[model samples]
Target chain A: MKNATITALNHAMATRQPVAFAKNLSDGTEFLLPDPHAPEALNEAGRLALAADKSTTHVLGSESWFIEARNPAPRLVLVGAVHIAQALAPLASMSGFEVILIDPRQGFGNQERFPGANLVNDWPDEALNQLKPDMRTAVVTLTHDPKLDDPALDRALHSNAFYIGALGSRKTHAARLERLSALGHQAESLQRIRGPVGLDIGSVTTPEIALSIIAEIVAVRRGGSLGLRVK
Target chain B: MIDVEDVLSIAASWHGAGEQVAIATVTETWGSSPRPAGSRMAVTTSGKMAGSVSGGCIEGAVAETAQQVMASGVPKLLSFGVTNERAWEVGLACGGKVQVFVEPLI
Candidate 1:
């Protein structure tokens, strides 16, 4: 039954148009139009069909279709342009992500310091306005300063950004929560945050810390808790 | 402009399209070179390519070698030495040595 659905979807996607499955070879053939707003299963069919036949298939609105075909390159937005961010940005960029480094501190968030990076020297709220954080966005705040880190976390927790983490020690994280709570951020939203963010891999140096943070983000995005430790 | 990944993607794309392509890579470099070794330029039997192995100094020579490899269906390594006094004639400005691997990509 599942295979049938997938096959039907594939058939639809291939025509570069939409297609319908003959519930039975007896029901007669029907070509269904693909819904642009269809679910993943439906879109998967559309993509599979396109891949199958290169000829005899005329794609309509191909410009729009190609635009849709280009998957949104997920962004790993770092709110602090610190050393860890400097290292993490390049590594993430190489891994096929559009990395954005935002810091209001001019000295830290300049192009010279992070060549090939989309550097934004603006406050988190203002930056988030221009670069909207959707579910595809993963945000990490490493300012280590409450003033800089808190506002970013506030905005991130409310946005659809998938991964939201803040860097600091346990004590600092606790203090940060108090500040957020005082600012009226809901506890449930705060719960979504990964504090002292990163895999529990005794990371002490700047690079190691960056690795741990990146690993944790990957774990969350993959929908796995591989780094969780049993006390 | 052909960036590093764009070059790699073109190579992969050509291979996927079932074209015979040879990739010549500069694995090392020295002295006032525009591109380092490990830089790659791919040449297809039909003469389409992405990337550059040398700063354009030895590209013609490499292109010739690439065509030979495609015709013969064999991969080989070719090198150019800029240390030779007449190296400037070939295109190397400062004395440098470049190792190029010409292999038919599957």
Candidate 2:
């Protein structure tokens, strides 16, 4: 709780970086790992704490140290504020994501459609450029329009966004891939986009589809597998 | 995220005001613990507290233990569970065990 530690923690939260606080139980000595992304600066215990992404106690040479990880809030960027997005945004917010909805259409991106969510009234490409998706961010194109979804997908695929999903039928996804390939995107890069977004849940309603999408996003974020569900 | 910010900020303010402060974190959990391992609670010498280690199941015990830790300047690892028979009295009726580490923030 020192002033320097508080300042560094505030800075890390503001800048969306990961930090860890290590306290030696024996002497009450404290050290702050302000940058978990910089592996070269961390010791073995620090690296383990960062990889675990959890607060834990480790003992080394008769000294016990408690390492607490302070990670920035995860973020979700939804392109094309449609009905499914309206349903997904609140759910994502509840699941600890800073949700942002982007659309050029005023009617779709208005407060009425996305209440209690950050609405970006700009084109997908422009919005994404300013956002600059990182490793803690997930981008989903709920807008089936190729004009909107394609641009956003192009931006997300290139960035370090952890998850990229697009809503469409299998046939539509095939055509979408073809378009991106023609525009010089590699096959490996295009594979990062989870077309026909969301888990196969036999969804029909907007909320159901939103649930599936959120489930898939969580699975991808937590490094869980999308194995087949047995009857 | 808000919970973490609230706990840390309260701890910082208490320390700034020259009060002894201690933080108790849920280091491990077994079975159906309400809060996860990283859950934190901050306490001061004046008995003021922020955040929670469990869902009101063992906050009182942890807070009381935190005061002792702040006074003695020694960290304590306390555990509570249904198997110990005090779980019912402490309200951890969810059939789980939790280990909390209370340490002074100097």
Candidate 3:
């Protein structure tokens, strides 16, 4: 690996832009992906590796190249500092997510209550706007009140966040969807939310619910199936 | 060359300082390998090392190979573990096998 390759890959990572480093094992040739100068064959292989979010070996005829995908760290934005948020924040962090808890209320969003989380003291919409949730982000609205959860969900719906979850019952989710519909969110986009958020593991306690939520987030991120249990 | 943690930026800083450096990455693993693929370790000419390709099983040999790679400006793919034919060549008595790619940071 040349210092030039390391510098370019580091630059891409520092900028939080996804990049793939391709190395030809047989010839010791190295190149960065998304480079117009690189051969089209390697570029396509890099594209596939990045899209799959993994490091893989691609063979073209007799040449084999290792494509290492380096994407920005995944982030989990908790829109309410409720009980579930307290339980879920650390779990998300353990699961390799940069957990951020957003709540304007000082008492709820304080560092003492939720340790090891980036706390946002602004309203959910403002916080989400400033945070600029991207494709690597997972957003969850833990406050059941429409005043708090609705705006957060609205902002999340507009962003490129890969996972959007809300803490509520099935009936609560129906009403929440109706309110979002009134705000002009199309039905198709609204379907992206995993309401009554979390997989169906018959969770009854706060911790169990939090576990279910994290499991569901992991399931979505890994492209795993929930079958009928999610309903 | 040293087994520890993921320190890519640190390696870049060393390269910026004009130090000869080499990086080794665990590209493949079999059976009960201590570290999974993508684990990395960086070594400098001054013997400074960080990160681990395994749970310290083959870092010493990798560090030595990294210095050679830095000197030669060439890359090498090394395999270790009891399963490999030359497993004892590097002192990886562990049961699983791991392939590490070592290259100079030129």
In terms of lDDT, which candidate is strongest? 3
> Which runs of model 3 end up more than 4 angstroms from their true locations?
A81-94, A98-100, A106-122, A126-135, A155-160, A168-215, A224-228, B1-5, B14-20, B28-37, B44-49, B54-61, B80-98
lDDT of 3 by residue, A1-231 (tens): 777776787677657788888888877888888889889998888788788787756788798777787776689999889898888987787776778899998899998897757899999999999999988899999988898899999999999998999989899999999999999999999988888789889999998999999898888877888622333
**Which CAPRI tier for candidate 3?**
acceptable
- Writing each residue's lDDT as its tens digit, candidate 3 over B14-46 gives 989989889888877778788766678899999
| TM-score leader | 2
Clashing pairs in 2: none
User: Residue A67 in candidate 3 has what lDDT?
Assistant: 78
User: Which lDDT value does model 3 have at A94?
Assistant: 71
Chain A TM-scores of each predicted structure, in the order given, are: 0.70, 0.83, 0.81
What is candidate 2's CA lDDT for residue B76? Answer: 88
Please say which candidate is ahead in lDDT: 1 or 3.
3
Error of 2 at A174 (Å): 3.5
Local lDDT at B42 for model 1: 85
Q: What DockQ, on C-alphas, does every prediction get?
A: 0.02, 0.36, 0.24
Which scores higher on DockQ, 1 or 3?
A: 3
TM-score attained by model 1: 0.55
Which of candidates 2 and 3 reaches a greater lDDT? 3
